[model samples]
Target: MIDIFLVPIALVVVLVMLHAWFGVGILKRGIIFTDLAIAQFAALGSAISLGYFHEEYFYILTLSFALLSAFLIAIASQREIKLEAFIGLLYVLGASGIMMVLSHSAEGMEHFKSLLASDILFTSPNDLYKSAIIYAFIALALWKILPKTKGFVRELLFFSLLALTVTSSVQLAGVLVVFVLLIAPAFVAISLELKKPLLYSFFFGWFFSIVAIIASYYFDLPTGYSIVFLGALLSSTIVLFSSKKNSAQN
Candidate 1:
C-alpha cells in the first residue's frame, strides 16, 4: 500500500509547488479564468484525438490547442477589450467543441467524465516522472527567463508557460483538478495577505492535496475530484471567513 501511494504523493508535491507559483501570478493579473480556458482548449484537443485518432497524437494536439488559446489570450491581454470575459468565451467555446467532437464516440461520456477529473490514485510512476520533468523545465523558465520579459512578450511567455503546464497537468490529473490546484491555494494566500504568499500557497496546496489523497484512499473516492473538492472548499472557506473578519474589524 505504501509503495503504491508513493508515486501519487510525489506527483501531488511536484504539482503543488509548480502550480502555486503560477497561481500567484494569475491572481495578480486578475485573469482568474485563464487556466480554465486554456485547460478547456487542451481538453478539446485531447477529445479530438480520442474521438478521431484514437489518442494517437494526444500530447501534440493538446499542446497545440492549449498554445492557440494562450496566444489568443496573450493578444487579448494586450488589447483594451474585456479580457476575463473574452477568456470565459474561449472556455465555453472549447467546452462545447469538446462535446461536439465526442458526440458520436461510443465512450464519449466516459471520456468526458475523465476529462473533467481523472482518477489520479492509480497514476503510474512513468506518468509522474514525465510530469515532474516537464514541470521542472517550466519552473526553470519561470525563474530565469520570465522576469526579463516585458509587455506583450511577457504576457505571451506567461500564458504560454501556463498552457504548457496545463497541457501536461490536464492529461495527468484533469481540467477541474488543474484549475483548482492552480487557483485555490493562491487565492487563499492572496486573500489573507500573507507575507510570503507563494510559499504559503505551496504549503496550503500540499496540505489539502495530501489530505485529499489520504481520504480518497480510505473512502474509495475519486482521487482527482476529492482533491478538487477539498482544495476549493478549504480555500474558499478560509478566504471568506478571513474577509468577513477583516471587514467587521474595519
Candidate 2:
C-alpha cells in the first residue's frame, strides 16, 4: 500500500539534509575531498560485506566501515599533511581495494552497481529506519562533540559528520554524488552572507533535493540525476541573483 514514488523523495530529503550539514562542516575545515574519500571507503566496506558477509548485514557493515573511515579522515585532517593529498590517497586505496574485493566474488556486479549508484526505489522502510538511526547518532554525537572539542576534538566531530555524509551519499548517489552533496549547498551558503550558513545550507539543500525528487517522480526521470541538476541550478541561480542584488546596491 506504500506509494513507491514518495519513498525515494522522502529518502532524498533526509539524505540531502545530512549531506548539506556535513558538507558545510567539511568546507569549514577546508577539506574538500574528505567526504568523497570517506564515501568511497564506505562503498569499499559495502562491497566487502556483499562479497563475504550475509546479505542482511551489508548495510550495517558498510555503515560501520564508513564511520571508521570518517574517524581516520578526521585524524588525517588534524595532521600537518595537505588534506587533498590525504583524501587522494584514501580514495585511491579504498577504490582499488573495493575492486579487488569485488573481483573475488560472484556478486561483484551487484556490489559494483550499488557502489556506482543505488536505486532508491528499492530501499524499504526498514532501510530508512536504519539510515535514520545512524544519522541521528552521528548528529547527536556531533552536537555533543563540536562545541566541547577543542582543536583535535573539533576535527573528530567533523569526522563523525563526514562519516554520516558518506553513508547518505552512498545511499543516494553511490560514490559519485558525494562531492556534489558536500560542495553544492556549501557553495550556495557561502554566497548568501547568511548569519547561519549551516542552517541555510541545510534548508536549501533539503528543499532543492525535494524539488528534484518530485520532479523526477512526475516526469519519470532519474531521481539522482534530477536532484543533482536541480541542486546545481538552484545554487547557480542564487549566486547569480545575489551578485546582481549586491551590484544594484552599490
Candidate 3:
C-alpha cells in the first residue's frame, strides 16, 4: 500500500508547489479561468492526436494548442476589452473542439472523461520524474525570470511557462485536476489573508490532496475527481464560513 501511493503523493507535492505559485498570480490577474482554458486547449491537442494521429506528436500538439491559447491570452491582457470572457470562450471552443475531434474514435467518451480528470492513483514513477524535471525548470523561471521582465514580453513568458507546465500536467493529472491544484490552495491562502500565502497554500493543498488519495483508495472512487471535489468543497466552505460578517453599530 505504501509503495503504491508514494509516487502519486510525490507527484502531487511537486504539482501543488508549482501550481500554488501560478495560482497566486492568476488570482491577482482576476482571470480565474485562464488555466482551465489553456488546459482545455492542451487536452484538445491530445484528443486530436488520439483521434486522428493515433497519439503521434502528442506532446507537440498538446503544447502547441496550450501555447496558442497562452499567446492569445497574453495579447488580450494588453487590450482594454473583457479578458475573462475571452478566456471563457476559448475554453468552450477547446472543449467543443475536443468533442468534434474525438467523435469518430471508439473510446471517445472515455477519452473525454479522462481528459477532464485522469485516474492518477496508478500513475507511474517515470511520469512523475519527467514532470518533476519540467516543473523544476518552470519554478526557476517563475522565481528568477518572471520578476525581472516587463511588458508584453513578461506576460508572454509567464503564460508560456504556465502553458508548458499545463502541457505536462494535463497529460499526467488531466484538466480539472490541474484547475483545482492551480486555484484551490491559492484561493484559500488569499481568502484567509495569510502572511505567507504561498506556504499556506502548499500545506493546504497537500493536506486535501493526500487525504483525497487515501479516501479514493479506500472507497474505490476516482482519485482525480476525488481530489477536485474535496479541494473545492473545503476551500469554498472555509472561505465562506471564515469570511467576516457585517455588523451594525449604534
Candidate 4:
C-alpha cells in the first residue's frame, strides 16, 4: 500500500508546488478562470488525439493548442472587451469542441470522465520526472526572465508557461484536479491573510491532497474527485470563516 501511494503522493506534491504560485498571480490579476480555460484547450487537444490518432503525438498536439490559446488570451487582454468574459468564452469553446470531437466514439463518455478526472493513482514515474523537468524550467523563467520583461511580453510569457504547465498537468491529473490545485490553495492563502501566502498555500494544498489520497485509498473512491472534493471543502470552509471574521472585526 505504501509503495502504491509513493509515486502519486510525489506527483501531487510537485503539482501543488508548481501551481500554487501561479494561483497567487491569477488571484491578483482577478482572472481566476484563466487556468481552467487554458486547461480546457489542452483537454480538447487530448480528445482530438483520442478520437483521431490513438494517442500518437498527443503531448505535442496538446501543447500546441494550449500555447495557441495562451497567445490569443494575451492578445485579447489588450482589447476593449472584458477579459474575464473572453476567457469564459474560450472555456466554452474548448469544452464544446471536445464533445463534438468525441461524439461518435463508443468510449466517448469514458474518455470524457478521464479527461475531467484522470486516474492519478496509476501515474507512472516517467510522467512525474517529465513534469518535474518542465516545471523546473518554468520556475526558472518566472524567477529570472519574467521580472525583466514588461507589458505584453510579460503577459505572454506568463500565460505561455501556464499553458505548458496545464498541458502536462491535465494528462497526469486531469482538468478538474488541475483547476482545483491551481485555484483553491491560492484562494485560501489569500483569504487567511498569511504573511507568506505562497508558502502557506503549498502547505495547505499538500496537506489536503495527501489526506484526500489516503482517504480515497481506504474508501475506494476516485482519487481525482476525492482530491477535488476535499480541496473545495476545506477552502470553502476557510473562506467562509475568514469572511465572517472580517465582518465581525469591522
Return the TM-score for each candidate structure. 0.97, 0.80, 0.97, 0.96
lDDT for predicted candidate 1 compared with the true structure = 0.94
Q: For model 2, what is the C-alpha lDDT against the true structure?
A: 0.74
- In model 3, how large is the Cα lDDT of residue 151? 97
lDDT of 4 by residue, 1-250 (tens): 6998999999999999989999999999898899999999999998899889887979998999899899999999878789999999999999999999999888888999988988788889998898899999999999999999989999999999999999999999999999999999999999888999999999999999999998998999999999999999999988997775457668
Residue pairs whose backbone atoms clash in candidate 2: none
**Consecutive 10-residue window with the lowest summed lDDT within model 1:** 241-250
Q: Which stretches of candidate 2 lie over 4 Å from their true place?
A: 54-60, 104-106, 232-250
Candidate number of the best lDDT = 3
Off by over 4 Å in 4: 245-250
- 99-127 in candidate 2: lDDT tens per residue? 88889787797768667656565568777
In angstroms, the error of model 4 at 221 is: 0.4
- The deviation in Å at residue 241 for candidate 3 is 0.9
Tell me how far candidate 3 lies from the true structure as C-alpha RMSD in angstroms: 1.7
Q: Candidate 3, residues 1-250: lDDT per residue as tens digits?
A: 6998998899999999999999999999999999999999999999999999999999999999999999999999999989999999999999999999998999999999999999898999899988999999998988898999999999999999999999999999999999999999999999999999999999999999999999999999999999999999999999999988867632
Ranking by lDDT: 3, 1, 4, 2
lDDT of each: 0.94, 0.74, 0.96, 0.93
